[model samples]
Target: MGFTDFFSDVWDTFSHPSPDADAGGKASTNTPSSGTDEESGDEKDVNKDDAKDGEDSEQGHKPSGDDDEAEEEEEEETVDPKDELEEECRNSQGCAQPKHHFDECQERVTGQIESDGKAKEDCVEEFFHLAHCVTSCAAPKLFAQLK
Candidate 1:
C-alpha cells in the first residue's frame, strides 16, 4: 500500500474502535440506550445485534481464523524483502546465510524505526547497509549469523 493508504488505515484503526470492543465486543441493549429521543425500530435492531454479539463473546467466541489468514495474505501481497535479498545473494556462496530469519529481525527493526522516529525506508536502508557487513564478510568469525 502507498504511505497515504497505510497511514489512513492506521489512523482509522486507532481513532474509531467499536464501542463494545474493550468490553469484549458486547453491549446490553436491554440496559437502555443513552438516547433521550426516540430510536427507530431498525436502530433498535442494530442495538439488539450489538447486544447479541456481546453476549456471544461472553459465552464463547471462537474466531474462525479468517483474520489470521487474511493478515497473512495481506503481508504476502506486500513486496517481500527476503525474496529480494535471496536473489541478491544468489551469485555468492557463503556470502549470505542459507536462510533469512526476517520475522525476528523485522520486529526489532520496526520497533527501532518507530522509537527512533525515522522513516521506514531510511531505517531499512541503514539495516541493509550494516547487514551487508555480515552478508559479504570474508571471515567466518566476523560472518553475520543471519539465520
Candidate 2:
C-alpha cells in the first residue's frame, strides 16, 4: 500500500476498532462462545475477574471536586513575602507622609488626564518618593530576618 493508504488504515483501525478485537487491534482469543460449553465456562470466569477489578477501582478513586477545593484552600492560605513587606511599609508611621503625597499626586494626575485627555506631568517623582520611603523602612527589617 501507498504511504497515505497505510496511515489511513492505521487511523481507521485505532478510531473504529472492531467489537471482537482487543485494544492492540488484534482479534480477542477469549471469545465468549464458539458453540462449545468449555469456552462459555471460561467467559464466565473472565467476567468475574473484570467485575472484581471494576469494584477495586471504584473503591480506590476519589471525586475530582474534593481535590480542587483542597488545592484552592492551600493557595489561599499562602502569602507572598514581597506583598507582606509592601503592606507593612504602607502601614508604618515612617511611610505615612510619603504615601499620602503619592496618593494625592495620583488623584491629581488622573483628573488631569480625564479632563484634558493627557497630563503634562506624570507622577513618577511622587511614586519614587513613596518607593524610597517604603524601601528605607523595609530593607533593614528584611535583612534582619534573613540568615
Candidate 2 residues 1-147, lDDT tens each? 899999999999799756755687654565544665555666689989988899867765676798898888788665666667877998889899999989998899899999999997888888899989888887777777664
Against the hidden reference, what TM-scores do the models get? 0.18, 0.47
lDDT of prediction 2: 0.81
Candidate 2 residue pairs that clash: none
lDDT of 1 by residue, 44-142 (tens): 899899898997666557677889888887785657555555455643454333224333466666787789865354345545644674455433422
**lDDT by candidate, in order shown:** 0.60, 0.81
lDDT: worst 10-residue window of model 1: 138-147
- What are the runs in model 1 whose C-alpha is more than 4 Å off? 1-57, 65-83, 92-134, 137-147
